[model samples]
Target: MGASGPAVLIAGPTASGKTALAVGLAAALGGEVINADSMQVYRELSILTARPTAAEMGGVPHHLFGHVAAGELYTVARWLADAEAALADVRARGRRPILVGGTGLYFSALVRGFSTVPAVPDAVRARWRERGAEIGPAGLHAILAERDPAMAARLRPTDPQRLLRALEVLEATGRSLADWQQETTRPLLGAGAWSGIVLTPDRTALRARIARRFAAMAAAGGLEEAARLDALGLDPVLPSMRAIGVPEMIAAARGDRSADDAVAAAITATRQYAKRQETWFRNQFSDWFRVDPLAGEGAALATALGHFGAGAGGAAG
Candidate 1:
């Protein structure tokens, strides 16, 4: 394997078989897997987040999975820094780095650079968090609408975390988050440094897969994971808590909702999230090679390997 050769990026929506494809490519190419999923970073909810199991890892070394505590706020900047280190480490060891996950922002930052948003002071963050708790997501969004309508219009009112972030940036830097986003640093992987693929499965088939996978998760300790996370009593607005299924599962575990109802809600949420992920990939990664992993992991792997073997350049499907 060439140490300086292009790193392979496998991105897809949930339940698209990204893990299997990545592990297969790693095994075939003398590579290692680096996580790019935001939810999979938490050490506390592996089952709920569907962090790949030990058996699923297929003896390939995986980096940055389940490494952070549930209570901490894990930012894109933090993930970018960790991914940079992981990439460098894998390359230094003469192994290919295969970054696989559904998080489009992570891939975008690595490939197209990230804006350096000024850090919020602890006091300023606390003040906004307090306001959020009192007024809720809609309230925070309304405040942002008043202060920075451009950023607010770009964000969903239901997303309290991002709304809070926008407010904090305005409070701390006296500038809108939109203004800060225009000042991006150099990309971690510039053109020709990495080859990427987006796994785009058929929507109907993907929805079925999402349903089946979540049902399997429910039967396989997902409730237990959610219960444990709830026991930690973390803030509801934290990213870990806001993971697709955690809140529903926690409700189920606490007897606030029946198990079946919780599972149904989670499945629905997961499908919705998958749709958003697909849209993001389609729009943002238009240049990357595309593969439908629903065709079978072997076929997907073969297609990706062929792309890589062909110098892994240009857009292809």
Candidate 2:
């Protein structure tokens, strides 16, 4: 909370203590915490998503957590609009807006603005899907390299979804995804109006924390939550259904796998997801403030406060 009114963004990999740090900062700076994590939006997923407990919020106001139904599709565009409104409301009340989460795309959309690419035609999409099914992702990626080298270079050959998207965008609009991205619209937080910090903790310690957190989730009725969500018969492709632990837990709940095996698989998947998040922040947010959680939580918050020029304050509303 710079006197000039800059929102604070706390981003990092999962199990890196981002939630604790964000809540502490919000309380100290008279700010409200806004969810930037895409997974945390689904109303049905509190435990598996690692959403903050009521007690853990520490009396600070929080927005956008567990607000969307698991059956609905929540996209980045919708999140940006919601976040803009949240920031406006928070600022109007004379409190800082602290956007915190592990999702890089949300932060990127906020700071760099959204790409206004046209929707791919359903026929074009279907064609690409059929091509992908016939030729496989690697082969499609090769075609993408020829049509959109810049986008292809950034995407993994094994990532069929992105590969298809890139190819479809090129075919439909005659523009690469990267090209569209370069022509961004107005960012929600304009230049110098926001500060961001990405927590960089030791990989080993983060993995261990992920394991412990998953175990805690199991003990905290995560299995029951998964059972309830699975019973809804939501589309497996939906973000909520693919949440880190939901699929594995659902498998166990359905007797497709043992509970112990599901837990282990979920823990492993979480670690893998954390690793991807870490890499993304490292690559995309190299200029943002970076602090090691192992160094200490207070130190990390102090660094953020220093960056934002926020003074000590009363409890957040």
CA RMSD (A), model 2: 4.2
* Candidate 1 lDDT (Cα, 0 to 1): 0.91
TM-score of each: 0.97, 0.85
Please provide, for model 2 over 169-238, each residue's C-alpha lDDT reduced to its tens digit, 9 standing for 90 to 100: 8999987889888888787877767777889998888888999999999989999999999999875646
| Global lDDT scores for all candidate models | 0.91, 0.85
Clash count per candidate: 0, 0
Find the 10 residues in a row with the least total lDDT in model 2.
308-317
**Best candidate (score: lDDT):** 1
Stretch of 10 with least lDDT, candidate 1: 308-317
Q: How well is each residue in 68-106 modelled by candidate 1, as lDDT tens digits?
A: 999999999999999999988999899988899999999
Once all C-alphas are superposed, what RMSD does model 1 give against the true structure? 1.5
Model 2 stretches with alpha carbons more than 4 Å out: 1-4, 120-153, 157-164, 167-175, 306-317
